[model samples]
Target: MALALLHTSPVHVPVFDALRDAHHPGFPLRHVVREELLAGAAARGPEAVAGEVTALVAELAAGGAAAVLCTCSTIGAVAEAAGSALAVPVLRVDRPMAAAAVRLGRVTVLATLASTLAPTRALLAEEARAAGLPGGDVRTVLVEGAWERFAAGDHDGCLDLVAAAADAVTGADVIVLAQGSMAAATARTTTALPVLSSPRPGLAAAVAAATRAAR
Candidate 1:
């Protein structure tokens, strides 16, 4: 079965490709990237943002995708809500990460974009509540000045800033990299705490869901 990934940026292409090769070898993939989707969502209101995500999900469904993974945390809720109306599973790429974080108790969500922190925290809270996990403190730490470097294509520098922030985090049961783009930074980080990134867990969840649905 084929799979489609809706991304807000091309930065995640390589990461997803590697992940697909490793986890779901030979699965045909289709990627639809709207580099400005997140930036545009800011100027647009909630309805517009939801509409954009819904439309993307529909397109993926129409393209024969057995499942769709929305790889943007900021618009994750919209994608998930849209999933309810579709036959195929449409999952937020961070859904698994959020679920994992909830089980870990004290969680620190690390992000480069301030916009993602709120939604990610909300997702973690929602996941925890659903699982009957006790309400735990979920804090957010934004890497100062990191987004600008990423916007400018200095990915190495951006990862450096994120790694520094991850290294400094203490006392959290788990550290979550808020964006799929930030997943690469996990390799650079050195910490005793479990550090979670979205791509692997999220894609694995999507594959499992899609496979079950197909059967």
Candidate 2:
């Protein structure tokens, strides 16, 4: 399926690629992201961000794209607005992911990008409550310097940072990796609970929604 994806970080392209490879390798997928989406997430707030995404979705729809997936988790609220404006299926990465993660109580979200972690937690908490766990625990552990190392091409360093954050998730029933870019190289640590990352849940939703809409 063809999808026009808006994202702030370009690293997520590989993450989504990995997800497609894992779950939907039979189908061809197209992905796009701009660095501005990540760097400008805080600066423009919702209106400006939503305007940019809405514009992108409109263009992709014009070009015969099957769906729109916004890759940056932080900008999902904006994507929600854009989805309302766009004609094609617009997949916001966070909501469905939050839904799946909420099914497990005592969720821990490991995030390299600290800027997006708070919202990730809030979304998880809200979903958990709605899913029947009113007092579920949600935790966030920042893997210090993970994103920096990845951007600097120190792939090993990125993995190391993610591994280090594993300590904070020791008691979690559900461990969620908030950012998609880190999914590819995130080093695994022992977890008795379910581990939810951006790639599978988000990519699955995108593929499912796009395929269904196209059908």
Candidate 3:
């Protein structure tokens, strides 16, 4: 199987690679990282973001990818909307995690980037509605100074900040890591609430979707 992953940060590559190796061994993976997408989304607006995602999805399909997974929460809606027009499946990496959050009732979504909060919250709402569940209370917490730590190449520090934030979250049925890059921090956190991250679940879904497409 050939799965293409669209990421807004290069940090997600190794995380996805390890997950893919452990879960879907022998599957060929193609990674496309566009750091600009994350940095420019707010200034570019939704329409521009949608256009960029649409083009990227098409490009991935043309490259013989059976499925494309968008790993950026900020552009998740755009990728999902673009999927309707493509034969190959296009999925947002956070979809499975978002749906899981809805099922858990009250979800607290944590993100290092402020841009991720709105889309992650929106996705959880959409999933809840589609599942015929009562709209759950989805809260967002932006980890202070986390993005700066990441910008400074302090990967461990950034992850520690995220895990610390997760550890402190209370009164939620689940804690959701809003970005693929945040998935690594999940292992280091000790939380009473279930903490969910995108990579493993997302790649599992991608493998399934690509398998179906191949058939």
The best candidate by lDDT is: 3
Task: Identify the candidate with maximal TM-score.
Answer: 3
Model 3 agreement with the true structure over 14-58: per-residue lDDT tens digits: 888888788888888999998877767856655577777788889
Task: Report the alpha-carbon TM-score of model 3 versus the true structure.
Answer: 0.96
Clash counts for all predictions: 0, 2, 0
Q: Any runs in candidate 3 off by more than 4 Å, and if so which? A: none
Q: Whole-model Cα lDDT per candidate?
A: 0.86, 0.72, 0.88
TM-score of model 1 (CA atoms): 0.95
Clashing pairs in 1: none
Candidate 2 per-residue lDDT over residues 30-76, each given as its tens digit: 66767776667655554556667777777877788788888777777
Worst 10 residues of 1 by lDDT: 40-49
Report the CA-based lDDT of candidate 2 relative to the real structure.
0.72
lDDT of 1 at 160: 94
**Which is the winner by lDDT between candidate 2 and candidate 3?**
3
Residue 51, model 1: Cα distance from true site in angstroms: 0.9
lDDT tens readout by residue for model 1, 6-115: 88999888888899899899877788898677986655633468887888899889878899988988888888899899999998999888888888889998999887
